[model samples]
Target: MFLALKEVGQSKIRYTLISLIMIAILFLVFFITGLANGLSFADSSSLQNLKTDYIVTNEEADGAVINSTLSEDQLKTIEEQLNQQSTPFSLTISAVEDKQGKEVNVAYFSVDTEKYSDIEIIEGKNISELTGNEVIINENIKNHGYELNDIIVDKISDTPMKIAGFSKNQTYTFLPVIYADFDLGMSNIYGDEPSYNAVLYTGEKVDISGFDTLTKNEAVKSIPGYTETQGSLMMMVVFLFIISAFVSTVFFFIITIQKLNQFGILKAVGADTKYIAKSIFIQVILLTTIGLSLSGLAIYGITQLLPGEMPFKISPTLMLGTAGLFLVLNLLGSLLSVYKVAKIDALEAIGRVE
Candidate 1:
């Protein structure tokens, strides 16, 4: 450790340049990771916010809520069979016209108010208190110029509803969510048919014939484009890791080659191969720590500057996990330089082999 510090102190410029490269690489990795998480949350915040452990969808729908349909009778049977408290809700992706006649895309969540009054109202009255054609909307809809008591008309049904409240993080499939009463919404949207897309249960899994039970994770995966988007972003993160490893290996290997004569002299003076290898490992760890710390600060600043609508989120767990993984990869990469140092012949390195 002492030798490594001394070397870095003597070659501050070179070490600083290497650290800068690492910082840039780590910052990009962290930024992309945050975006991946943010997009996921924005796409399914409504479902993610639910405390339920599992969801029931029609077997024919193959676990996808959008494709599933359950009548009031089927929901009662499932409730009796499972003997658990459940929430029934229906979803539809459609557009509603604001008071100004401007169309705004929305994900309508028609829920049974008595059974599921979990939609938190950040402003105005709760959905349960709403009577007549009143709906609660996601706070994000405020970006589109809607406010409490504003009137929005359903383009399809020509039914006008008043915005009763605003809720936070209530989005579905990247669209702002609007919560409505089940009886009123189903009658208007589905022509007097009392049906729901799925049922949310708050207990262990139980198999019910003709219906498919999906865990939270399974249901999340079933969201359209969710798997594909996450896979692509994750692939980019993996590639960045590979690039960081390659950069670390080459940088340290070159440095080791440049200092062979000095290493030979040290070995002759009783400095062992283990000491030299430890120096390389210590250098890698030090540089990685500095890079990761700076990258974290940089990401925090960037998130602050980003707009609220931008899908960018940061979690401490992700940051720490990424930093730990980066440190490990860099250590593994430095092994090549360590191996080269171990193979050095003290006599030949000092030009005394002849």
Candidate 2:
């Protein structure tokens, strides 16, 4: 270990370049991990945080909330039979105008507002005040210059709007969320008769009998690209790492061959093959550690720069997995050099001089 660091310190420039390769590979691994998490969150934010066990939507819709609609009356029917509180899934509705004259696509959820416990008010009145004209938005939009009492204009029926308050960071289908009264929620999207996209079952699984009810995990898969996108990205992440391990192995093998005479001298002087192997392996671990640590910081900075819709999430478990993968890969790379070391001829270094 001491000699390895000593070698690194002496020719730091050359070693820096070698270490850079490790850094670049680790950076890519972490970056893809971030993308995987981000895309999943972006794809499932609608139902991920809901305090419900399952969602009830029209079976024909095949789990798509944005395209499905159920009448509020249907919601009432489901509620009456409930063992616990259920929420009407008021999703869909696009191209809303803020009274301030800006236009954006939005997802509006119509809850009884007074019923759910997770829908916290971070900056405005409780959802009970969300009426036909009053609306609640997320901090993400509010940070975009929209403030309390400001009107958001909507081209759909030229809906009149007022920011009654702001809520914590709750999002749906990757869009910044806007919560409103059930009547306003429907009027904003349907323009008339109000309805919900689905119903959320919170207690002892409201018996839908003939209707379909999906657990929270099952519901997110209905979001377009939710499963396939994550599956594809995850595949790419694995493929990239396999390539990296091979590349590192090849590079280390070449470096080992060039140092054969030196290794032979050490071996001839009583150093065992185990010592050489251990030294080579330690170098691999050190190189990968440096790369991955640097990339972790870089990925975090990049995540902060992205919008809420960008599904790049940071999970502690994932970081640990990434670190573990890097270490294993580098160990595999170092092991490849052992074959070359085993072939070194101790006699060659004795009197052979260039």
Candidate 3:
């Protein structure tokens, strides 16, 4: 370790160059990872945040909540069969016009406020406390200049709804959500008759005939583009990991070759192969630690500076997992260099330059 630090200090520019390269590669990995997580959250947060365990949909809808419909008879049968209280909610895509006449797309979630209101209000009154056309919405809609007590017109129904409050992290299909009273939403947005898109079930198992049950996570896949988008971004992240390993391996392998003569001299002076290998290990550890730390900080700053509309989230689990994976890859990549150092013949390597 002492010798490794001495060498790095003496060859500051070389070590710095390699460290910079590591930082660049790691920065790209972290940024893309955060972007992927953010987009996934944006795509399914509305359902993810729901407290229910499974969603009961009409078997004919093929597990799609948007396409599912449960009549009053089916709802009663399901409640009785399961012998539990189930909350019926409806979700649909709609648009609202801001005061400036600009249209912003939104997912309208109509929940029975008295039965199940899982939305966490960040501002204003709770939806349960409101009536008629009053609604609570995702706080992100504030970005469109709509705020507490502001009125936004529903594009489809042409009904002006008051923004009673705002909730955080509520979205579906990459569109911010608006939570409305179940009965009122049916009258204004859906229709005059009472109907629901799906029922929220919190039971362990559901086997009712004529109905398909999906876990909350499984239901997110039913959202359009959720699977395809996640798969594509995840593939890019996997390739980046491969590239990091390759870059680290080649860089250290070449460096090891250049230091053969020095390694031979050290061995001739009584240093063992284990001692030499430890030096390479120490150097790799030091470089990776410094590089990943700096990259994490840089990515955090970039996420903060990014536009609010741009979906980007950074979580501690992701950062730690990424850093841990990177460190392991770099350590494994340096094994070739360690093996080269271990096999150096003191006499042959020393005489090569002569």
TM-score winner between candidates 1 and 3:
3
The candidate with the higher TM-score, 1 or 2, is 1
- Please write out the lDDT profile of model 2 over residues 1-354, one tens digit for every residue: 865666567768866887788778777888888888877776566577776777887777787776676776776777776757666767755666544556777767667666654567788776766656788876667545788888876556566678888876567656777777666644335555666677777656655655567788878887877778888998999998998888888878887877788888988989888888877877777777887778777777777887754567767789888889768877977777987787777877555655
Report the lDDT tens digits of candidate 1 across residue range 62-165. Answer: 76788888887998888888897788878887788765678888888887677775666799878668788788889988877888998888777777888889
Off by more than 4 A, model 3: 186-192, 352-354
Winner on TM-score (2 vs 3): 3
Model 3 / residue 83 / CA error / Å: 1.6
Candidate 3 whole-model C-alpha lDDT, 0 to 1: 0.86
What is candidate 2's TM-score against the reference?
Answer: 0.85
Q: Quote the positional error of residue 121 for candidate 3 in Å.
A: 1.6
- Candidate achieving higher lDDT, 2 or 3: 3
The lowest-lDDT stretch of 10 consecutive residues in candidate 2 is 183-192
lDDT (0 to 1) per candidate: 0.86, 0.73, 0.86
Flag regions of model 1 displaced more than 4 Å. 98-101, 186-192
